[model samples]
Target: MFDNVGYRPGRKPQNATQEAIFAFHVALRTGMRSGEVLQLGARTLDVGRRVAVVEHKTQRYTGKPRRVPLLSPAVRLLKPFAVQERIFTIDDADRDALFRKVRDRLMLKHLDFHDSRATALTHMSRKVPVQVLSRISGHKDIRILVNRYYRESAEDIAKRFA
Candidate 1:
């Protein structure tokens, strides 16, 4: 499905399709929501520190800022546009439309951009503790992290134990 975007990793995004793909990559890598990923700017992202501290969904309830650790892949994706006020020029509507087009072409029933958060956190659960994953994901409740986001199949878990 992403093949239609014609985006090769490490290449600068040249068009809207490529930009949307890159934005998806950033969200996948950072575990950031689509809005947070789109809102990212040089002011919020610290490539040098490999972290992005921003006001996010749980900040209001938690009374703490969300600190998103930028993995190497995310750092590479953002480095090019780090100087810009907005990392991704793509807006919500454009992104939604672009993703909808891809979803339709690929015949995917549920391919929303917001799914990146669950996908990212699921992947992170394998390597990080639940507490750490919650921090990365800005989930105040560990139950939400384990029950909602960390979706590993029983077979997959059994294989790890085996």
Candidate 2:
């Protein structure tokens, strides 16, 4: 979908300004929500262990913390952007502004930052099961996830029946 916007799969972003871009790619690759990505702090990531501690948004079913394994690409992108105490900080408004700029720069129309979360879920569904995906996504219910986040293609269904 973003091929026209110069989104090359497995391509690393070039600069600090593109850190968010790199982060976005990592989020999608790891099936993380945008809020989870935004809330990441220095203590959240353990580069040596290649793990990330994620605080799930207080939802009914999932009120505790969960851990996500970091991929090599995500680790590489995050190391340079990591600060002493804070990993990444941006206010809500600033986040929105940044999203707008990134969307425009990428020539994406009507795409919001939160959409990245959806994209991540959609893409990762093929590789992982709903149960594992729910853990990473912090979704309270698997049914909600199946209904909302997981994107199924008609071809996928046809192939299943065939």
Give me the candidate number with maximum lDDT. Answer: 1
| Residue 43 shift from truth in candidate 1, angstroms | 0.8
Error of 1 at 27 (Å): 1.2
Question: How well is each residue in 1-162 modelled by candidate 2, as lDDT tens digits?
Answer: 334334454444334334455456657666676666766667787877877787766734566567877767667766654544654455445556666777787677788666667787776676778897787676768998888777778898587679
Candidate 2 yields a Cα-based lDDT of 0.65
Q: What are the candidates' C-alpha RMSDs?
A: 1.9, 4.4
CA lDDT of 79 in candidate 2?
66
| CA RMSD (A), model 2 | 4.4
C-alpha lDDT of all candidate models, in order: 0.81, 0.65
Candidate 2 ranges with C-alpha deviation above 4 Å: 1-20, 59-63, 80-84, 157-162
Clashes of each: 0, 0
Q: Tell me the spans in candidate 1 whose CA falls farther than 4 Å from its real position.
A: 62-64
